[model samples]
Target: MLAQIAEKASDPAGRKIHPREVERVFGALLASSEFWRVVALSRLPVETVAEIIKALIDVGLAVQENGALRLTPGGNARARARGIVPLIERTCPGCTGRGIDLRPYAELLDQFKELVQNRPNAILEYDQGYVTPETTVARLALLAAKGDLQDKELIILGDDDLVSIAAALSGLPRRVVVLEIDPRLTDFIQTLAGTHHLAIEVYRQDLRRRLPAELCRQFDTFLTDPPETIPALELFLTRGLAALKGPCCAGYFGLTYAESSLAEWLTIQQILAGKLKVVVTDIIHNFNEYVNWDYLLESVRKDLSFVQVSPRANWYFSSMYRIETLADYDQENRDRENLALYPGENLS
Candidate 1:
């Protein structure tokens, strides 16, 4: 019998046997009376033996039919082909024993650790939860389309996170320069560009400080997702505006509470009103948590007055600028309000 088994194992066809065949062989071996007698004599628990049989079935080596476990034809062939007994085991219980899903933020962080180092630490410091790349990309695309970013020079005020990376990937701007405060982050960004072969200029300068001379009046588009604080807001919007060539497009977070944050967004609008028209106003919500329409509309009203002004500084506020709330993404309503605020094909 041993010689016959050796001959069968030596066959090239057996070596190429399918996995299913091996599973059946295990099932048949376990179901044999001789094997059961040995298992009982060895004092092995019935539950343990049953568990092993179940594992064989789970791995597709054995099948149960008419209350009898048996080796499938393919399982027998696979065992002979492999010239070894296959050990089937139960699937791992932790994490469902399945691999991680690569589509979410957690998986991306794992895969691109070098790009997003110390992710948990950074997130905890920011007190902001993670967002999926898909959601981030979709929102950015919407913003770009609304702002008419194509054929425009964009000035990004921060580069520590995925937003800067997304902007580089979008290729929506004619020229893109990222201004960041941390030198370490700046170095990381440079290394990121080199590793990914992306063309992006990174500047290691504080927003509170005067912008580099080369950046003055050089940007047509502006994107700001600044830190949610009074000092940071003032520095980024006020100082950063100096770099914009105008007409400019920008977005700011409108907090429901804290008059200071609301005031800061308005302050940015006021500054931009002097040069660029507030062409589009979008409110990106923090998930479905809350809406700050009151704060948003207040800022819009103030900014519109400036946009409606005439070329002359004195005549600008005389005529009321028709400030219309264009679009709002409210997670609570599960609906987006898209209103045409201004007339003309250009605004469309």
Candidate 2:
């Protein structure tokens, strides 16, 4: 059964389908019948999960009913015979699996919510979607827990999530600077900062270009939620690394298995340890829950007839990574070429 599914699910881009991930897909089905729930629980890309589901249905192991997946009696028996079972819900309820409680930051959450109540809606061109305001506060809580917030000069590469505002509200970071391509976000953040007297600076900068000279090696911490493309991974991480003051300075970013495969995850992990010379201190799974983007209604995927269901909930999420520099890296000497620019291919 597994081999049949694996053969059918072989990625055209050559992404290997790991047996553990297949087990996870089965485990996710055992845990939930909703299609999106399975995608979220399996911690795989929605596209990959969709292919796996199609394969499962073709193999007569699973059936789709009203956007839910159900295993046949034979399939259920086979799963149990293979010792597969539902995932135990061991995460802390209060923290929502973030392992750090948000109760302590109640005031911060309140301020963040109120401030972003009329925040700019996400735009498709930028691949932008902001996390729920509470998720923003939770991210700030994690940063504070790691001692990366208070009295630290922070730089935010992208501000659609408006993390700069939340960090400023904490009255912790020594300074907050945002380099955002979206004028709507920049204007909104600047207005809020001026009205609230927050020490935040906004610049209309694009990450595709070089970092500003003055901003290089000037920050204590950096925050960004970059796109999952490999070029994006290198550009965002390298730029963030370049902005840090020295070793011990930290950077926080989000990556999702939905858009990035485990193979891509390996590449990112290698980049962090090898080229960037950073030590990964923490990786909190499902740490950021994005508000459903409005763009999905007209997205190409939404029109695909083969997909039996569409996302009914804010199921898109990403794991947060905190990396600290192992040694002072020469930002000027960093290599930009040879990064993966496409599926299974490295750029020259």
Instruction: Compare the candidates by lDDT and give the number of the best one.
Output: 2
Give per-model TM-scores.
Answer: 0.42, 0.91
lDDT per model vs. reference: 0.43, 0.82
Show model 2 residue runs off by greater than 4 Å. Answer: 297-308, 333-348
Specify the highest-TM-score model's number. 2
Model 2 is weakest, by summed lDDT over 10 consecutive residues, at 299-308
Q: For model 2, what is the alpha-carbon lDDT of residue 113?
A: 84
Positional deviation of residue 96's Cα in model 2 after best superposition, in angstroms: 1.1
| Count of clashes, each model | 11, 1
In model 1, state the lDDT of residue 62: 51
Q: How accurate is candidate 2 locally (lDDT)?
A: 0.82
Q: How big is the positional error of residue 264 in model 2, measured in Å on the Cα after superposition?
A: 0.8
Structure candidate 2, residue pairs in collision = 45-258
